[model samples]
Target: MSRLTAAEQKALAERVLDIESRAVSALAGRLDDSFAKACQLCLDLTGRVVVTGMGKSGHIARKIAATLASTGTPAFYMHPAEASHGDLGMITGQDLMLAVSNSGETQEVITILPLVKRMGAKLISMTGKPKSTLAKAADVHFDVSVEEEACPLNLAPTASTTATLAMGDALAVALLESRGFTAEDFALSHPSGSLGKRLLLRVADVMHSGEAIPMVTADVSLSAGLVEMSQKGLGMTAVVDQQQHILGIFTDGDLRRTLDSGVDVHKVPMAEVMHRNCKTIPVDILAAEAIHVMEEHKINGLLVINEDGVLVGALNIHDLFRAGIV
Candidate 1:
């Protein structure tokens, strides 16, 4: 069914990528005062940005709306064809409409312009034809015109859609900086994602606390510390003073070393075998930071301390894995 050889197919694929890349690159040099004004309009809006388009442009519009919403701007996509069927009610007077159409003359998109104006909403249009109805009617216009389509026949939307998506990204990043959007803010919008877990999960949230903590008094026998570690399943036991302040930690590695020296586990005290001045983390630090501490010290676990230097909890690499932080 195919007439082209393998080499011809590869050439076609490369040409598509080349044309699309150039289309997006050209948009970088065309940025003007209108781009800034567009960002400002979105930043200053009291309500959301309502993006709408038809056909292939609609797909790009939906992505742009999602990007805006996730990057500290309130925005959503509205189907242009469905707008006339009562979906226009989603728009309020405080909202701004971002309409996308390569030709700027899409009938469904243009039909809602009069209604949007009567409702007192501002308009921003992304289009190839600056003089087309949709572009001329907007309060601000972004020209996404390209040299030509990447389609071999120069008819498909290949290049224009890529240019429009790049322009939308430019608007989003500019607005993100102007709004002072931080990673923590992004975590709030993506609470179910891995970044949210890294940013929002705290040491206290994952560390074993109360009776579950593997702890032993410094005067306890090394054998007794081993029993505590086995019971708590944390691979190590914290050695604490009577006031609950951490003294040191005794791990399985310490056990092997003590055994090699022919020391009796039943006779040696935890204070004699424990590692002194071991790493400890604050309870309020991020769980991600806990991982960093473990890696920095080349240890498998850490003791958690409160503001008063009291050992309150403990956690190991296994805990990080269970919490999806690893």
Candidate 2:
């Protein structure tokens, strides 16, 4: 094995990045009526977008399909080889077919073109060569051509694949905006992911409600508040009035400050030692927003109140962690 100098390695990496970056940028100028027609084709379709390619193009096709599916478009990748065997049946008249090939002459993809057309599916092609048979056969074509591959030999699919992927992203994003897709809609599609937890999980969903909430009446002794905080294990207890309206909050930090003042915990009322202007949030806001409030105020816990300003629940940083909103 041979090792290159650090300077040589850095130069080579930068050269590749420069080529790929230029290739992606060039795609912006290439967008015209064809791009708009392609987007409209996908938007007008009643079925999923079926993406297919061979070799290196197939790998990029799979990623493009996944991105489209996650961003509000219904899309899936069908292997050209598998389609030639039997998977071609997946294509329906309602689908929009996106065929990818740098040379635009992949035999595997070309073989299924006739069957796809016979099924009344609309065809879109992405190819480096506009004159290639695959591009000529499509109803709409996108030129994913690049000046040169990032590879030293210009043989590997480098700059061309990067351009194709970027083009795919542009298509998905344009469609996402056209359909008025929101972050909440994206979150619903990805319910098990971190973004979903942040956008879809509300404070009430993870809050400790009912008897699980650590609370004590304003008249309760500081000793009793400590017991409630310990029992609920939230590091804080809400001090409420007789009608369950929040008056103040006592936390571990308050206890430390009281100790410094030499106050007797057994004799002091919770309302006297508690923070009078504690932060509160409604139960319907995003849990992620609650985390923002906590970070801004430098507090670990918050009291949850309803529209009537009555305490209904409580949550801390730990709850956010458990809900994957942290």
lDDT of each: 0.94, 0.94
lDDT against true structure, model 2: 0.94
Q: Please give the distance, in angstroms, between residue 54's alpha carbon in candidate 1 and its true position after superposition.
A: 1.8
lDDT of 1 by residue, 27-91 (tens): 88888898889988988899999999999999999999999999999999999999999999999
Colliding residue pairs in candidate 2: none
Off by over 4 Å in 2: 241-243, 275-278, 295-298, 307-310, 321-326
- Identify the candidate with maximal lDDT: 1
lDDT of 2 by residue, 1-326 (tens): 54988899999999999999999999889889988899899899899999999899999999999999999899999999999889999999999999999999999999999999999999999999999999999999999999999999999999999999999999999999999999889999999899999999999999999999999998878899999999999999999988999899999998899999998889999878999988999988989999999999998999999999999999999999988998
Which one wins on TM-score? 1
Backbone-clash count (model 1):
0
Cα distance off (Å), candidate 1, residue 92: 0.9
lDDT of 1: 0.94
For candidate 1, give the lDDT of residue 39: 86
